[model samples]
Target chain A: MALDYALLVLAAPASGHSSLTAVRFARALLARGHSLQRVFFLDNGTLTGLAAAVTPQDEHSPLQQWAQLAEEHQTELILCISSALKRGLLDSTEATRHERPGATVHPAFELGGLGLLVEAAQTADRLVTFG
Target chain B: MTAAARKSILVVSRHAHPGSSLPRSALDTALAAAAFDQPVALLFQGEGVLQLLSEQDSRAAGVRNLRKVLDSLPLYEIETLHVDAAAAAAFGLDRDALPAGAEWLDAAGIRALLARHDHVLGF
Candidate 1:
């Protein structure tokens, strides 16, 4: 039977190479005909969804890339709501909570809690983390 | 058995190398498990403590600093965060340097904690 996988991206953008590696791995998993149930962004990895920041010309922005992949593949992009909120990452709900002017969450992303993590582990055939 | 009674997971991360991808990956797994309502614990060992160090700037490299994600742990309902006391001291890290509410544990404590978990992932 084909395997269903969950890819966890945890490296901070500048701290390490996990984001890029994860993207590659996700692509590979898809190419192999495996199903990607979700991409869970945690800790520094959550920054992968912030599209507002200006990236340099030379650098590869994992956030933008992941967002595009998630959109194209219909992969679930989940940003830990607690982590996102504390870091000033507001979804529509959060923008209203702090009376922010607008939502910081991108289109391909959703704010979620820990329960999503559990579901990924229980439901997927393999839980692959890129840390 | 009920889903809630399933095995707990332990993730041990010891590196926070500049531009390394493991930290974010580890965090992703932890958050995903927590989001799924699975029991998960994150343990910081060795150089991994640097991940919690405050005021990191990834702008020079055109990246978002990851400290923001660490700040979001409680929001994900992933409250069982831990750091090795000896490792923290060896790295000259103090409580203030980490996110608020992170627990400090010694090697023995961490080992005991690991024993209780059903799975352990080291990065």
Candidate 2:
């Protein structure tokens, strides 16, 4: 039977291939008919939502693939609000309040609290993290 | 937070205090799981064992005292704590010098323990 999977991506883009591998794992699970409950980004993983990141040609950018996965499969992409704010990743609403430049987090990702993590932990059959 | 659905979780904390907030955050996560009655085990490896040193004084550095939080783990129903033996030794920490309750685990022991958990979270 197909199981619910929660993929928690915790590595920064510069830190080796963890984030890329996470995206690949997500794709493989989806291909095999597993249900992706959500992809929760924490710490440096939130950088994946930074819209201004430009990947050089000949390189595979999992950040872009994460956005694409959300678009195609409607997967929930959540970044911890506290971690995001601390890292200076501000959405438009937060930008207006903080008076900083608006952040690059794509519209496909939502800034949420750690409570969502608890929910995922409670409901998902499997919780996998890559960092 | 009913007790019936608690998952078996292993939390591997890999950083130090006064530099990274992850150790405290990992504690909070463990506390949350404990509050929900999840069976949780905490393992301190790498620089994470530094949080367990006796003279930490993290508060003077403007960070919350992770050592204090760790002391309260039992109150939160989280009593299983482990320290990586090799990591501790590499950091020049003697097993007897650690806090009163944490057990020691070697690399193989840590791996075997992790294999038994339904979920493993690293910091």
The count of residue-pair clashes in candidate 1 stands at 37
| Model 1 / residue B72 / CA error / Å | 20
After superposition, candidate 1 runs with Cα above 4 Å error = A14-16, B1-8, B13-44, B47-123
Off by over 4 Å in 2: B18-21, B35-37, B58-64, B106-112
The CAPRI quality class of candidate 1 comes to incorrect
Question: How would you class the docking of model 2?
Answer: medium
lDDT of 1 by residue, A13-102 (tens): 555777888888998889999899798777666777775866678998777878878877999999877667767778887888799998
lDDT of each: 0.77, 0.82
- Report the number of the highest-DockQ candidate: 2
- Fnat of each prediction, in sequence: 0.29, 0.41
Model 1 sits at an interface RMSD, in angstroms, of 4.6
**Candidate 1 per-residue C-alpha lDDT over B1-123 given as tens digits, one digit per residue, 9 for 90 to 100:** 376557677888887845666676578667777766678889999889888888788888775577788888889887767999888888888677788868899878988998887666666
